[model samples]
Target: MRAIVLTEPQAVALVNDWPDPEPGPGDVVVAIRAVGLCGSDLSVYDGDRAVPSLPWVMGHEGGGEIVATGPGVVDRHVGQRVVIEPNYCCFDCVACRNGRTSACDRRRIVGMNDPGLLAERVAVPARFTWPVPATVSDGALGCTEPLAVARTAVRRSGVAPGDRCLVVGAGSQGLFTCQTLLAAGAQVSVTEPHEGRLELAEQLGAKRVETAEVEPFPLVFDTAGVPAAWDTSLRAVAGGGTVVMIGMSRSPVSVSTRELVQRQVTIVGSLIYDHPTDFSATAAAVADGSVTPEQVLQAGSHPENAAAAFAKAREAPGKSWIDLSSWREESA
Candidate 1:
């Protein structure tokens, strides 16, 4: 089997003889069709974030057909097309017990913690797979993981129809969040300095703002995880309103707790999606034509164009995918 390996920082290579994954009980071997690139992928490639180990197969957002199924996996079988949920949660954890599986104390995100699915075929737990209908578009498939994240944020927001909502940043996450907000019946407004992204936001039926509104919003989503964006989010959300913090930023922001204390503003930190529900919500929206995530993603990049894909992924960033079909065919 062949796989894309990151041997070192800023170095990714295709290895032709990587060993095939052996499915254990409750697992299935997926004939990987595509792998979505993430911002974290760029950070790891640039040596900004640390990986658990080197020579890693780096992809958490991908899906394909099931070629094999392990024992106890009765609900799923061969030839089933599914997307990987990536987050492996410990159901016994405090968070999981409280209905917050996304924050499970012991959760491993594949491609970041475990080996990823950037190969011709990879073994994954059958429970983490979500089946997609043949009607779902490729664009939707390209952003399953991200849409799940967006879905979680919306689920956390407790948003109501006709409520005013603002999403800071028009990146892939921001755009998806914007669309999800709309699908949830919130009047969405997007803030981004990038003209192109703002344009895209308007196309998604969101009002594009030149800046983050200083006025209060019932729910505000901050997808841009920078210190400045944090400050703006705190300032923009009104008293008694909720701020859904969706950015995975490590940088610290110095802000007063006056708004939180005096105004009763709530800040909710969101990681990835909760198991089962989030993916199902997102996939349903895609299936119903309520949202189109692949609008931000480009065409598939073959293994032969891995170099070009990396460069393109870096250029546009976080909107690229490695097409595993070619290699899967070769193996066949």
Candidate 2:
């Protein structure tokens, strides 16, 4: 088996001869097909995000075919194409009891705490796998994880019918946020400096707004973690409207207390999905053409070219996929 091992910050390698993993009780082994590179992968690569340990397998958004199942599993999901849900939580936690499992007292994200999907095969808890519809493209299945995050953000922000929503960014997550809002019947607008991302946002059903045109919208969604993005979002949301923060900022920024008090603006923060259901819903949305993952996926890279993939993602315009099957040619 081959896996991209992140040994340290800004360092990764395609390691060969890694022993193949076998499924445990209540687990499933997936022969990974396609994986999407996300900001979290970059964060992990850059050592910005917190992880329980290192030697990390740095991808979570992926889909694969089930090659085997554990002893206790009886779902008959073997040979099924599925997407891996990366979140695992302690169900007894207060947050999980309240349906806020993303904030669970004990949470282990797949790539961060355990082995992830950026490899030739991944063995994960059977509960974490969701059936990928035959109608959905493989690349689209690879995108459901992020789409779930976007869906969670929309669900948290209380975006409603006829509301004017402002998404302050046009990257992968931001674009999906726009799409989710638009699908919910909100009048969606987006702010992005990148021409390519902006164009994609428009194609995904968002009105593009230049910095000069910033105004108060009914609801503001900030997926860009930069201070300027939130500052602009604060200025763009109407009085008493909510501004939801989805991006992971490295540090805290000062807010305009007077403006927040005067306008009664609500600032909310969203985290990751905690269970398989979120992933399932997102998968269904993609399968139904609601969230077009195909449009957002730019290209793929082989596991051996993981470093090249990172460089490309940093230089290129949009999301990139990790093609784990790239090693098969060598074997052949």
Candidate 3:
């Protein structure tokens, strides 16, 4: 099997002789078809995001076909098309028991804690695999993970039909958030410093696209983790409204407690998706054309050129994907 290994910070290597994955009980081996390079991948590559370990295979947003199943895996079988959920939770945790799997006491992100989908094959727990409709392309299916995150953010915002909402940033996750809000019948507005990304946001159903300055919205989502965007989001939400923080930011910034108290603002930090619900909902949205994946994924690179793929992802306004099947031709 061929895998792209993040050998060290700012280094990526494509290794052709990586051992193939062997599934455990209740697991299945998936032949990865398409994998999207994420902003987190860039963070890991640049040493901005600390991982549990290094030299890790670097991808979690992917979809593929099931090639084999391990013992006790009955419901999923060979030849099934599926998207990887990526978040592995400890089912015994109190949060998991309460059906809040995203908040499980011990959760392992696939690429960060375990081997990721940036390879020819990956072994994932059957429970973490969701069957995707054939109507969706492999590249589109690869986007389900991020779309799930977007859906979770929108759900946490409590935005209702015809409500005014603002999303800060026009990156892949931000654009997906905008579309999710639009699907929920919210009047969406987006803020992006980049002109091209701002236009892309409008195409993704944002009714208003502005350059970082905007009126107060009843609901606001901060998908850009920069301090300025955070400050803008905090100030952009109307009094008594809600703001959801979906982007990860390591730097600390000061906030006005008095403002929050006086205005009665609701602030929430949304993590990854809720296992089956958010993942399934995102897949359904993709299949139904409610959230167009192509709008966010603008290009694809062969996994053999994994480094180039990462570079494209870093520079491109949209998401960059890796075609994992390309290794077969190279090996042949």
Q: Which number leads on TM-score?
A: 3
- Which of the two, 2 or 3, has more TM-score? 3
- What ranking emerges by lDDT with the best candidate at the front? 3, 1, 2
Q: What TM-score would every model get versus the actual structure? A: 0.93, 0.94, 0.95
The positional error of residue 86 in candidate 3, measured at the CA in angstroms, is 0.1
lDDT of 1 by residue, 1-332 (tens): 88998889878899988888999999999988888887777777777878888888888888888899998899998887787888899899898988789888789878887888888888999999888876765446668888889888888888889999989888778888887888888999878777777877888889976563457788889998888788778878888988899977778888677747898889999888777788777767777777778767767788777756765574462367877867666766
In model 1, how large is the Cα lDDT of residue 119? 86
For 111-160, candidate 3 gives per-residue lDDT tens digits of: 77667788888899999888877677878867888989999988877779
**What is the overall TM-score of model 2 with all chains considered together?**
0.94
Candidate order (TM-score): 3, 2, 1
lDDT of 2 by residue, 25-115 (tens): 9989888878888887888778887667767777888887888898999984777888888888878889889877888878877787777
Q: What lDDT score is found at residue 3 in candidate 2? A: 82
- Measured with C-alpha atoms, the lDDT of residue 243 in candidate 2 is 89
Residue pairs of candidate 2 with colliding backbone atoms: none
Best by lDDT: 3
lDDT of model number 2: 0.81
Model 3 worst lDDT window (10 residues) = 323-332
